[model samples]
Target: MLRLILILFLCGLLASCQYQRPEDARVQIQEIEGQARFTIDGQVHEIKGLAGHTHLQEAHSIGANTIRTYDTTGLQSILDSAHHFGLKVVAGIWLPKSHVPWLYKNEEQRVKLSKELAVLGRKYRDHPALLSWCLGNELIFYDLMDFDFSSTYNRLLDSLRSGDPEHPVGTAFANYGHKAILNFALKIRSLDYLIINTFGRLPKLSEDMNDLDFLWSKPFLIGEFGENGPWETEWTKWGAPLEPSSSQKAEITGRRFKELPREHPNFLGALFFNWGWRHEQTDTWFNVFSKDGERSALYYALAKQYGDSPVPEIPKIKNLKIDHGTNANDFWFESNQWHEAQLEIPESLNQDSLEIRWSIRTEDWFFLKADSPPPLPDLIEYASDRQKIRFKTPGKAGPFRLYVSIHDRSGHFAAANLPFYVVQ
Candidate 1:
């Protein structure tokens, strides 16, 4: 009896020491009842997420269940923080774009990257907060047509799969055009799902997906969507894209979220374009938050759509005009000439608690090149009278934009910019 008891105790100890994968840690896509749905372990999950890594706690508070990153930098910390906030992470694994042909051609380099990715897959595969692995973000599809590039990409995907079979792997493409669809259909069969980043084209995304169903019918996520990107909007005669006011952006964001095809059989839900601060075109073009961590009108819009209880009221900015004219498309000013601009806000907002600031920045024209963001233009000072400002145009003969930022005491902000050309 003593021997039997000792044996039973030993068996229990061994069982306790045995390694077991965490429950509900596996993430994948399944076709249940002819509909593709993302599943955690065996339970279906709809991804209401943000394609950024900051403000995770705030994101969770606003009903965002997932956060997507663009690279693995600080991934462990991001995963930890996300877990702390009960948020899942769609961790991104950055890959060299097709622009770097030499990297793809060098078999040694390609092998090294694959090995590194495999290690990463093994390292974080079991994290409870991990939802999926995104291989790349908006890689140039035109260059991906090269055999070397396509093979390299597929090999990397295979490497990731070898290390983690429990999680799904995918890539993000920009604006799903026919060429992109055809290329993906023929060369990229390894992805568990596809991620498409659409801005102005978001409303028609469902139509495009249906029309190209024969070419590619896999599940997809709207990896990024928001207001029209700078590249997709109307430009001034001198070529500066007209950015919408904060109020307009909020409206657009709400409209786009509502237009998402949540009922589509292959839809896996959408992730808003930006959840944190980004200096893409202007400092405010894509950022939903300010540099000081203040929430913008975009944030309130998302919060309301995300079903935040008691959503905070968004401050309003209306009737922004330059030199008493509402049309910026035909506006041009002499170099160094003073011009007046005005905007009105709701009288309900207390003026004493609001801080209004203004400036002018050179229009960002370097979109095609992957370079450092253009230096912020010199502070063209303005005399402010509440919501009205008088500022002199820049002395240069190029496109410039006047900007206004209004901050309320409650940590909310409103921003607007008007594009104009300065002539010699």
Candidate 2:
């Protein structure tokens, strides 16, 4: 009885010393998963600034349970926080020397380097926050090595497996032609997933994974992607400045329409390329959001799509006809001359929950107001941000302000003021 009492006291002491991280401020991988509705292998945007814990939390909020670090400095904090938040981490050991197929000419040097990576594996292997060990980032840049990477990958996997049997191991292959890609695949052990960097041929991304040509293999991810480098025809890639805004929408939306399906069975996860704004190189242009956070519609599209959504987002609004509410792109109604001047709602937002916000400013720039309470429109779900809103005044013909703001039941809203000329 005395021994039992002492044991209970010891148990209490251990429990008391256990760490408790903030609820909203995430801690480790296991913690955040409790709140996550689905697993998201999201790209981390500003992962460099604060310690890895802070960066990992930001990724968690956006529905990611895993992140691939660009480097190894803040790894421990990231790993710790990720574990608490139910977030997993892909530690990127980018040994640029690894890129050169024969950088380490001597067998002794190669052995030493292999040992270096093994040391890394040994250090973090048992941590609760680990997801996979990405042997190296873009090392196989179609690299011609005297000592093939297959020997090294198999070796590294052996090394990591020695330390941690709990997780899987992988290596990132830089962009490659289908034939070369397939050859590489043949060499390595089938991984939990494959990482392919195919930027120019995105539609082909799905096709590449499908194996319409070669015999099928395990699941894969577009570990790195964007429209073609500036070299590719402007005619071919999505839009302007590589259409950074539109490209994200096109990439993810296309993936959703084409490849996003939990039912697909083999698909596991994906880690998009570098998170921060890296403009030192003119060729790399896949960043979705800017350093300042001026997000494109695609950002919201991903948010709404992953969080919860009733329907796919409609194509972007374009070439609007002001008076008739009609457009080369849409048939929305627009009018003048009293209540009749109101624009008709587009059928796209019809029957869907949405929120749209837009505004019009006269040459003089005073916003109009709606005489009555706003109605929910099919186009926009929620509108906020601009200080100015447009609505129709009590009379349609008074030449009064025509500030119109509409919020549909779906929650989408658009408010804009247009300068006048009565209907033709």
Candidate 3:
């Protein structure tokens, strides 16, 4: 009798200790009536989200169902926070550009990195918030026909798969041509999908995809899309890119969102280029939010598209003009010269409820090599006013941009910048 009781207790203990899979743990792509759709645990799911780590709750509130990251830094916390907010995560794994020869040649380093990635996969595969694994972000394939690099990448993919077969794996590419697509089709057999990061070229994406269907036909995501990139915009006499004002950016956002192939059979979804502040060509280039966490016109534009009801009013900057200049971009300033600037806002907006701030920073002109953001430049101290202001240019001769941020009482703001060259 005693032995039988002990056996029963052990059986009960074993039953309780058995691992149970989390709900919706398996994510994959399925062809339903010739349409490739993403399915989470056999239920079709569409990704509507942005590509940044901050503002998870806001993203959820604005009707975003997913969040995309560029790398695994602080990933465990991000995944947990996302789950808490009922948002899914497309976890990105960082990879070096293909032009780097040493990474492919060094077998030991490759094996180490592969093992680390596999460990990450195994560790997070069961996390309920995980949607899929994006193997890399905007990695350029210099020689798609190179067998050695293909083999190395495949080994990495194999490592990830071995650790977690429940999730799908894909990679992000900068909008590439047919040769790269053909190479992906021929060599990268393990990839479940593709992610293309396009900016100015987004309008023609449908045409581009249709043209390349003969080479590759897998479902793809717009990994990054937003306003026109600095590389594709008009340049000033001093070669500075003319950045659009916040209101203009909102207009562009709406237009680009409309151009997305949401109705296409193979279109998965898109993650807007950025959801948080970033210093790229300019501090405000792709950032939807301000440094102080104020929502900009771009954010409101996206919020409306994502189903935010009763969207708040966006502050407008009719135009920012320098002294005696017809257009903001046509101005040049002398070193340390005081200039009066005029900011035009509609009379409908209550001027008393708005807070205006200004700053001057050196233009980020680096194009090829990636570098850290330059130090913050001096801020312009202005007396309380909304329409006119006086400020001095930098004391040295170089390219600089004057930035203005107007915040309303309702947590909405507008941003605009004007580029000027300082002459001695």
Candidate 4:
């Protein structure tokens, strides 16, 4: 019995001694040929990334090396999946919302935030897939005073650094126009990089950065850049933004990616705005994929830009509007109203095996706040390469969007959506 006990103790001691805790394995920025490039594991790593949650396999298959999340929720899965695909992660930590006017001055809030960040750091700091710590997403969008903003950010930065000293800290801003905020960000010694999330301004990103050359100090990355946002568009008196078509969005996003590297040499990398579906002003406004998991034109456009070999030759929607309007905007319909949608597919595609599907559902703006159930599409005819389809609108009086997708037997597909109001 004494010999058995001694043998078990020896085995346990050996196991404990052999185990090594993972340490900081973060990416660093290196100046290469007058251009800022990412260096990981002593090798120059150029970041080709996507923002938001999606199938990591798809992201990696499309040549993206990194992915960013808006928050740390379900982060273990994200990190695990990213590692499986040889992808890195820009882990996000959400900050207090603007509704908490005195969050900066509240000691309790600060302590709570620090504790949470410490826990996250301890849990993830050693992971091989971690690229950097993104402190927050557009944290300055709130109405906080200068002192509060600076102090709060400093506190969070301190906590992050304390927990993980090797990885650099980053925070995303809505834009770079706020001089006071920009200057304050420069004052934070702990901050290593500044991430900017932009939509329409992406095309002129290099010019904008050049304008800030005198004030810019740290390396930067395009944290989010994609289609034109509804918030930037002209809105009616009813508070609905006039959104652009999906095709127009694809064109703009494709151009943004093409122009980024050429125009901004100092820029480290970019993460395409969104990879998963989410509720914004319009359900289809910013996401590259639909709620039903259908890939939009922007997806293919990005795949091509990212050098996806044998990139799928997906069809493009020439026009998807209600009642065959003069254009693809200002569409309105009544509840229970019968409407005919006209879809114009490109004439160059093989029509024989082209599988087409159309659907309609309630506008998904509510999906942004919480994990409410995904809106289900109303029944519409499914046919092969149909140009026109008729369906009855839902009785519920609210906003809705009409979606269509065309798929080929080769597993390549294209999609588009239009938002319209359902009146009483």
Largest TM-score belongs to which candidate? 1
lDDT (Cα, tens digit) per residue for candidate 1, span 1-424 = 8985675455334323422233444776888887788888798887788989999989988888988999999999999999999888888888777668666789999999999888988998889899998998877767433668777887888788778877888888887777666565666655778888999988788888888897568789888998899899987777777888888888888789888887789888889978998776677888899888998888878888776656576566875788788788777888888778887788787787888887777777775333324434543444446687777777778877777888988899988888888889
Better of 2 and 4 by TM-score: 4
Q: How far is candidate 2 from the true structure (C-alpha RMSD, Å)?
A: 18.7
For candidate 2, the per-residue lDDT at 235 reads 21
lDDT of 4 by residue, 1-424 (tens): 8985674455334323321212434556767888877777758878888987677888887788889998888999889889999998888888764335567678887888887777778788788888888887776543323455555667777777767765667788886656534444343435677788887777666666677676555578888887767767665444556565566777877677776645366788889988877867555677777676777777777787786555456666777767877343456667887878888877887777787777776665542543322555654654443878887877877776677767766645566666677778
Q: For residues 1-424, could you state the per-residue lDDT of candidate 3 as single tens digits? A: 8985675455334323422233454887777776777788898877787989898988987888888998999999999999999988989998887666677778997899889878988999899999988997766665644656766787888788778877888898877456566556666655788888889888788788788787567788888999888999898888889888888898899999898887778888899978988777877788888777888888778778887656666688888877846364567878888887778878888888888877677777874334324534543546667567777887889888777778888888888888888899
* Model 4 residue pairs with clashes: none
TM-score of 2: 0.52
Off by over 4 Å in 1: 1-25, 143-145, 367-384
How far in Å is the alpha carbon of 194 misplaced in model 4?
0.2
Clashes of 4: 0
Instruction: List where candidate 2 sits over 4 angstroms from the true fold.
Output: 1-55, 97-104, 141-148, 189-192, 210-216, 225-265, 272-274, 280-284, 292-296, 309-424
Can you tell me which runs of candidate 4 are displaced by over 4 Å? 1-26, 98-102, 141-144, 234-239, 242-248, 261-265, 313-315, 328-339, 348-355, 359-386, 391-401, 407-413, 419-424
- The window of 10 residues in a row where model 2 has the poorest summed lDDT is 43-52
Q: So what's the TM-score on candidate 4?
A: 0.79
Ordering by lDDT: 1, 3, 4, 2
lDDT of 1: 0.79
TM-scores of the models, in the order given: 0.89, 0.52, 0.88, 0.79
